[model samples]
Target: MSDDVRNIDDALSRITAYWQPHRLTSINDYDVKVVKIHGEFVWHDHPDTDELFMVLNGELIIQLRDRDVVLGPNDVFVVPRGVEHRPKADEEVHALLFEPKGTVNTGSAGGEMTSPLRELP
Candidate 1:
């Protein structure tokens, strides 16, 4: 898609699968992505890139090595590079992610939650 206004709610509504990230747009060397998720994600660390997680719906708890950060709708948290963490939710949550292009969902600790990049819905 070309540069244009985007409604994250509308974009999030179109997602059909959990944990599958759909790239919404790109800026410079980063890609903006949205995904639907629930439960706990694998513990991983992006050694070279920080990850932004912005909650669009529901709630999420980012479990860090030292503590947990709780996020609700409209909340945003940045997990620093090389900081091991895991995301967990009791119910389904919709969220946006901003990180460098090619930053995997599971980071360097690849696991079942690792997702292939997908075109925007």
Candidate 2:
């Protein structure tokens, strides 16, 4: 995307991979990204930056050690820095994520689920 008007839905439509982040744009050093997620993600936490999740479609459960924060379409949640979170979905979920550039989806717990960042169209 150029330095022009950006529609979140339009950007998300270009993505076909689950658990991978496609960079939508940058706000300072942070990357605005869109991703499709299914099943449960690894439990991890950003040691330096807060992670933002905006549910655009379907539902998401931000499972924490003590509680779960459920989000539906049009809902937003911020997992505070250093707090553990595992994003889970029973079905497909489309979401917009905002976090620092180079932040991995799996945090420090690298595994097969880890994906290299992809540029947005």
TM-score of each: 0.93, 0.92
Report lDDT (CA) for all predictions: 0.91, 0.90
lDDT of 2 at 12: 81
Q: Residues 29-108, candidate 1: write the lDDT tens digits.
A: 99999999898999999999999999988999999989999999999999999999999999999999998989889999
* Candidate 2 lDDT score at position 63: 99
Deviation of model 1 at 33, angstroms:
0.6
List where candidate 1 sits over 4 angstroms from the true fold: none
Native-referenced Cα lDDT, model 1: 0.91
User: Model 1: which ten-residue window has the lowest total lDDT?
Assistant: 1-10
How many residue-pair clashes does candidate 2 contain? 1
lDDT of 2 at 17: 78
